[model samples]
Target: EEAGEHVLEVEVSLPELAELLGEELRLPAIRPRGREAVLSDVRRYRSIRRTGPESLRHFRRTFRTALRRQIAEGTYEPDRPVVVPRREDRRYRSWRIAEVPQSNAAVIYMMDVSGSMGTEQKEIVRIEAFWIDTWLRSQYRNIEVRYIVHDAAAREVDRHSFFHLRESGGTKISSAYELCSRIVEERYSPMEWNVYPFHFSDGDNWSGGDTRTCMELLREKLLPRVNVFCYGQVKSAYGSGQFKVDLDDELGDDGRVLTSEIPDREGILPSIRTFLGTGR
Candidate 1:
């Protein structure tokens, strides 16, 4: 039983794992439309043997012949003698090298960490971000991700801090946008990077003037450089819920601006698909 189990484990391959993931995720067979094709076929490359026949099938035959020769020579002492294989007894497996294009994407995830963004809203953002990252990774080999969390002010942080940090300061959405624009200008150039900036909030801002400033930043600085700028308004009881409407009224004609309402965790997946499905 142990030997059988060991054999079964050794026989399991990468293709089998890929098939399992495919079935579990129910990922659509859709590939990125224009440049690089999705990975449809998954398999393992076989290694070449250094000794005997070049092919495994041929090597097996040669191995059998060598054993038979030893038996005929009458030098096959079961206890002390051994059989030596010649150079023709080796075999090997073959595979092709697959070259894939590098996708230049920079995802800036900005979120409001004010008192209004409660545990439930944060959970939704976490779930949605995971799916977005997974889908983007599948599509691009070179995906750069940046996380910014804000309350009264905006600051760049690592992934852990972005999702976990909490504050009780007032909301100023424009501050976050300004920080994002600066990051793009200093670190990520529009010509070299395909930018995707996503902001999540409870749709509340400090003032209308700040919101107007946010719009100006998006219009003159962010919108032209990015492939898509997505805004997700997470519903909160404490929130006034006015930012999304303002964005729609101002930037509805811009193809690059995408806005969605994430009422709860259940809406996270669809919202993510809405933001990324365009392959922009």
Candidate 2:
């Protein structure tokens, strides 16, 4: 009662944050597609043996064995029913250790660094990316993340540069898609890896030709290989906001392709659900 230090320390783990995101957004657990390349050792107790530790003793089998022994020896009586298991009658469980397939994932994050995408838009992308990574990490045993940013052209960068690097130029959304396709082809094989590509942009493209190129890349190269292709259109004051509309009109019928319009930071959760709720 004398000590007045009443401070409580709170630490939120990545798994806990992932659980919160799933609960709030009603997200479905992702079902990995394609061959699971990773293997994990799993032990299953399926057979009974004669000797083992007491922890693994099979009581029913031991009693049955004792009763059979007594009956054979003519020591078991109907009036006075009792069963005592001898040391030789003890039964135990035996386990079979096997290698089972485990699913692994690769997440490729793409963002537009054009002049139109402002600080607020990047911040929204950063926050959304963090939550999405948290949820995906919880789902898969091994996960790899790659970052690509584009203005007039696209280039791969580290996590720090992906979010903070500033670029002032015209936007070409197709460049990022091309880079993503290359990365997927070289590193992540469709038969072995569950690939997820998430792209954030202001929905401002330099030309309709580039938009067409993006759609072509997605349909021919990206969509066929990935588990899901998610496009998040972060709102910007100078953005034309036409790319999402085009994606809706073109790829809406494909379940592997998803697009969400993030008007502001408040829309992050719903967008996440839209991207992941299908369990693909």
Candidate 3:
């Protein structure tokens, strides 16, 4: 009976994820809109100087010229082959800064570090975050990533600390939202940058009041500036899982707002697809 009660499990390939993501999310490449152009150092051999380093010598041209000179000057010896290049033969490539404009993007990642959110929940966020970063980077020439973690409070952290952060205290979803809003306003302007702010949690807030604060922040402050606000509510055993419902009720039929329920590690890719699929 146990042998016959088997189920089919499909394995998702990483290469296929990239292909599927491309098909599902057709985000337009952002074009930079700014007066200040980005500077890039480029090497060119357009101008060959009389004296230069050996590295950039025009070997073929120099050899041909030397052969002509040697033959004309009666220095050519067919019996003993020897052709020497003068200092004029040497040419070095010059590098100059080329100013170019490019569309830029920033991804702000926020997560609940509260006790109810366990290791597995954080793991889901980590995996999804990796894929999201890859996809966004592919779409933009310049990409900035910021991480915020919150329990009863929120704080900005480095990438290493952000994913490794452990569960603690109670959840105050508002703190992370508030910080994320500030980052968007200060660093990533709507005109200059294509901003993407993503939040991950177990859908457990300190209270309905804090949830209201989060909603206000999203609706009033964040949504206006960012390209999109993505929220992934990872399932947790100790979590109430009510915040997902709250977001749904408060923010109805909003194209810019995306929310996904990630049940486990396996849900990471699907959650990412749903969040980024809107093509905002």
Candidate 4:
């Protein structure tokens, strides 16, 4: 039994990752909720005119024009009626640009960066986010991502900063929701884009008042404006982890808002399924 030892090596490519994520989560292929305007250059033989490249020359029209010209000009001798096509007799096809309406989507990711949310939680978020991105990217023609991080306050950050930054402060979960709502309002129009918002945290908050505020924002501004809003509560030894309970108790199976509890890396994929399987 090789000294009762075992090892496993795992390697995943982009396509494989997407497939695995979809399979594990049982995610439905998303149909983007809103319409996008697309410009397309369409080539058609809609019109024919007597001036084009040789490749586009209309043979029948050119021969007819040549014959008509010879007959009308009195150059058609009955014994030998000769007709030659001139450059002016050639015809060609043309094309035009048309505007098409397509569908698009955007993903907004937010996270709690208080001391309670440590390296392990962030790692889970990163891995789950990767798979989520893979699936959503495949679903929409054009997709965009925005990141926000919060400790006592929320700030916009790049993808790198969202995953790596650390802050030792009290948790203000509502701040993140406020900023996320503003971003959605300003940049992603619900009528024109399929908006998805995901937030991960250790379920800690400064106060129950703030949690109520977050709930209001979701029910009013966010739930009405996004295709789906997902929340993931990561377990932490230092956190009270009460925010998840509050959301579940308040929202109570609302389709627009989904919640998942991820205890660690092992729970990442399952949480993904719980959050996205509804196909919202």
Best by TM-score: 2
> How would you encode candidate 4's per-residue C-alpha lDDT over 114-226 as one tens digit per residue?
88888988999999999889887655557899999999999999999999999999999899999999999999897788888999998889899999999999998899999
Backbone-clash count (model 4): 0
Clashes of 3: 0
Off-target runs (Cα >4 Å) in candidate 3 are 1-20, 23-101
Q: For this target, which candidate reaches the highest lDDT against the unseen true structure?
A: 2
| lDDT on C-alpha atoms for all candidate structures | 0.76, 0.87, 0.77, 0.81
**Per-residue lDDT tens digits of candidate 3, residues 26-72?**
54333444332254444424444556676756565566677787888
Query: Between candidates 2 and 4, which one is better according to TM-score?
Result: 2
- The regions of model 4 sitting more than 4 angstroms off are 1-13, 37-102
TM-score of model number 2: 0.75
lDDT of 2 by residue, 29-62 (tens): 7777667855678775656799899988877678
lDDT of 3 at 78: 67
Error of 4 at 60 (Å): 56
In model 1, the runs with Cα more than 4 Å from the true position are 1-99
In terms of lDDT, model 2 sits at 0.87
